[model samples]
Target: MFAEIKNIKSEKSDLRKFGITIGVILLVIAGFLFWKEKESFQIILAIGITLFIAGIVKPNILKP
Candidate 1:
């Protein structure tokens, strides 16, 4: 369920915004996990950061 590039216009669309929100939440969780010295934190941190950046730079990458 993705909209075409031509339909996105100049601003971030709803999907992009939602993705960004989830990414931020994941990042926060990852930070907390890191503070607690959890090993899985690295994986979560990576995914979180990637999603966060992608959500802003290329949101369509997450589609499909």
Candidate 2:
């Protein structure tokens, strides 16, 4: 049981890292889109913001 709990903690830590990485990537893409002045910039920005928020709220949501 102790080992299982340890494994779960590690998994959650990994998921948090993964979530942050994904969020950063999305934000970067949004930044690029804004720099390029693309019509889809707002859409991507919104998605990026949502993902970033989701990453914070529940890192495991993006896990799979």
- Top TM-score prediction, candidate number: 1
lDDT of 2 at 16: 73
The segments of candidate 2 whose C-alpha lies over 4 angstroms from its true place after superposition are 1-10
- Per-residue CA lDDT of model 2 for 27-52, tens digit only, reads 88888988988878787777777777
Report clash pairs, candidate 2.
none
For every model shown, what is its TM-score relative to the native structure? 0.73, 0.65
Backbone collision tally, model 2: 0
How far off is residue 19 in model 2, in Å? 1.1
The alpha-carbon lDDT assigned to residue 9 of candidate 2 equals 46
Q: Write the per-residue lDDT of candidate 1 for residues 16-51, one digit (tens) a residue.
A: 776688889999999999899999999988888888
Model 1: residue 44 alpha-carbon error in angstroms = 0.4
Report, for every candidate in turn, its global Cα lDDT versus the true structure. Answer: 0.79, 0.73
Going through the candidates in the order shown, the clash numbers are: 0, 0
